[model samples]
Target: MIPKYRKQFNKEFSDEKYSQLKGILAKKGGIEPTFRISESPIFLTKEFESKLIDASESIISQIKTLPAEILQKAIPDNCRVPNDTDKPHFFTIDFGICRSENGAIEPQLIELQAFPSLYAFQKVYEETYCEVYPFLSEIRNPMSHETFKNHLKELIVGDENPENVILLEIFPEKQKTAIDFSLTEKLLGIKTVCLTKVKKEGLKLYYENDEKHTEIKRIYNRVIFDELDNIPDLKTEFDFREEVDVKWITHPNWFFKISKFLLPLLKHQFVPKSYFLHEFPEHESLENFVLKPLFSFAGSGVNLNPTIEITSAIKDKENYILQRKVNYEPLFEDINREFSKAEIRLLYIWRENDEYPILLENLGRMTKAAMVNVDFNKKDAIWIGSSNAFFG
Candidate 1:
């Protein structure tokens, strides 16, 4: 992170300017973000940028050659989602700064998700960021509007009417991250339909559009298998194992195959020692480890401070992972001359024919709390919530 510009940004920063920036984002596609937006965008130096890219690419290369048998073993025998595509369409690698044994700061892997995050909304948010600070345009944008648009078209609406492709979510409007769904609809002309609303008839799926039933040719999935278990009584024809006649832009099985489930398989300098909780031998001194539920999202079910009794109480050990907690070095400067440790999410988009997942964009969070989400910190705070980065 650059210190000089960060100081300049703080000196020139105003609540009025931030409010205007939020207004600009809200006016775009006519929707306001439900989550908090940070007061500053992170500024990454060239050295830090290269380290991040190198770490991500190295992990991706290793993942490509991983045997199918190993991945299958990672998924629960009964919980495997059918129609496996083997490759994830989207993923994010989260990195946190930590001090090495030699007292040097290094980026350590926190967790990675094969699931789609706030893909559509982050792009619009970056544009609003540039609008607020034109001087920051020299910084490299990991994702371009043109490339992102074309990629979305290729994956979601390829050779088909945009209306025929739908973003599948469970009660999307009620979800905290639903703003991305609305933005996706606005940008790509695709509609958002809940899983329970999908009508399955004779192996074909359809959703009502303007009271006319329209055939669904492709699905941009946003539903999580973990979430489906809670709503077992809901009436819907949605079944991952049903073998419906449809193309999944991001297949459901990949969500299980390439998630925290795959974290233990990955060994790199940037990654920490992570083990499946059930497989880990006892008396492992969990004081330095974090207990994480494999399938939860948005920092849910992650224990920074774990007790022996708490770990022992978990009945489903296979559903958990014990990761060595990295000591987060506060890198991003705040108004009080104190820095807040940050978590950087490097986002990627894998195309149909690409050799690897393309680095699309990033989400940066600087927080005062033990964790780094809007839900964990206050909005009016000095440095916290969702943020962007200025590279150059």
Candidate 2:
């Protein structure tokens, strides 16, 4: 974080300005986000921004080199979909701020998800920030309006018709991430249909749109195997592996293959020490480790400061990972009292047959609690919520 921008932003920040931002977001995004919106965006110096990119590239380099057999081992057989895409179309790399042994600020890998995130909403969020803080226009945004819109269209629809490509999610209107779904539909002209509404006849999938059944050509998937496996009532006519005549924008297998499953295999300095619970050596201690369910989403089954008894009680050690807990440096101090820790998620996109994924944007989370999740943020904190980044 840059101190000068923080000071200037905080001095200029007011309750009215925040309210205006909130109203503009709800109007422009076409839906109010269920999550918190931070009062201030993280201002990044060129030096720190370079460090974040270098750290991300280092981890991605390792991910790119993983053997095919090992990658196959990461996805559960039950969750594998037909017609694997061979690579992820979208991925996000998360990093937490930490202090090196020399006390200098450093970025440590927190987690990675080989799936699409708030792609559409991030563009709106960035634009809203610039509107409120006009001076921010001088900063280099990770993605411009044209850059985001063009890349998203190419990935989701390409040469195909937008109506034939759906942003697939379950009960999308009720989900917390519905804002992104709505924004995606707005920007790309794609439909956001609920899983239950996808009518499957023979081997083709269709969704009723404006009284006509629209054929599905491709799916920009937002559904997760973890959710589908857990929620029994969330049934659909077509299973993900039913050999349906539709292309998967991002293959589901990558969700499990490149997630926490790969963390244990990575040996990067930025990546914390991680190991499969079942394969951890006897010399390793559980006191400093956190237990994470291999396939859970949104921090569902992560047990921070886990004990040996807790680790032993896990029925399937193979479905869990033990990662050494990395200490977060409280990097942002509010104008008066609240303190915050932050994490950055590097968003990337890779089209079919592309050489590699391109970094499209960056998302930041600021929280005044133990974890970066909005659920963990204390309500009284000023800068505890979601934010964007501006690089000088």
Candidate 3:
């Protein structure tokens, strides 16, 4: 985080501008963002942007070498399917990083989700960032909102009609993050329906609209199998892997393809030394690393400072990983106000037409806690969760 920009923004901060931001988000159905939207966009020198891009390339390269078999083994026991066929298609990676103890910057793989993230909403936020704050003229946000929409259309629909594709999720209306799914519907003109609502007529999937049925040729899947176990009564006629005929935006295998399991395999100065807990060499001094459940979402079941007894309690050590912790420097300024520590989630979208993934969006998460999770975040914290601010 750049201190000069933070200081300047805090000096010129106005509640009226923040109110306008709230109005913009309200129109888009976004929760009012709590973090400060700077008067001027934070400028990233080419050197800094290159470092971020290099870090991403390093991670992607490491992911390429990870064996599919290893990922199959890492699936949580509660969510395991007989074979890979039962898995949801595709995954998006979120990287969390800060300047490491060694003074060089490196990333820590934070959250991995099988579900769709706030893709479309992020685009809207980007535009709001530009509109509400006009001072950001020198810095580029790196991601373009329009390009993101086009990329999703290309990735999900290809040459097919958008009507045939469905943005699939489970009990979508009841999901906490349904606002994002709604945004996707508005942007792509695709229907967002629940798994149970999906009907099977021969091999194709269909959903009813205004008492009429429409075929589902492709699915932008948002269901997480782990969450399904929580509600057993909801029945679906078809299994995702066995009988579904639609194409997947992210082929289910990639969820396992790009995950925390690959963190240890990546060779980068930014990546902490990681090892499968089961294969980790026995050491009395195990306090140096943090233990994380391989497939858990958010920061669930992560022991930042683990005790030997807690480490010993791990039933399937292979299902867990130990990563060296990176201290997040609280770098944002609020003019003697509490500083919200932040992590930048660089979002990339891979399209069929493109040879490589496109850097589409940059998502920022802020918290007044020691860590960025809900548990660690301070109460009444102004900025938390998904956010985008102008960067010239």
RMSD of each: 1.8, 1.3, 3.5
* TM-score per candidate, chains pooled: 0.95, 0.97, 0.86
Model 3 gets an lDDT of: 0.65
Q: In angstroms, how far off is 296's CA in candidate 2? A: 0.9
Which lDDT tens digits does candidate 3 get at residues 1-392?
55555666667667687678768866785444333433223333355556667877776655546566766665554444333433333335555546676786445555544345667777777677657765543454654667667777877777788788888888877766676777788888888888898889887778886577888887787776555667868799767556456777766555654677776776776566788888777763468788888766667888888887997887878778888777765555565566556666666766554445666666666666766764566565555445654342
Better of 2 and 3 by TM-score: 2
Per-residue error (Å), model 3, residue 108? 4.1
Q: Which ten residues in a row have the lowest lDDT in candidate 2?
A: 226-235
**What is the total number of backbone clashes in candidate 1?**
0
Clashing pairs in 2: none
Report every candidate's CA lDDT.
0.82, 0.85, 0.65
Order the numbered candidates by TM-score, best leading: 2, 1, 3
Of 1 and 2, the candidate ranking higher by TM-score: 2
Candidate 1 local lDDT, 258-349, one digit each (tens): 78887888889989888888887676778988898988878888898888799889998988999988888877787677787787888888
Q: How far does residue 11 in candidate 1 sit from its true spot (Å)?
A: 2.1
lDDT of 3 at 277: 86
Candidate 1: list runs displaced more than 4 Å.
281-283
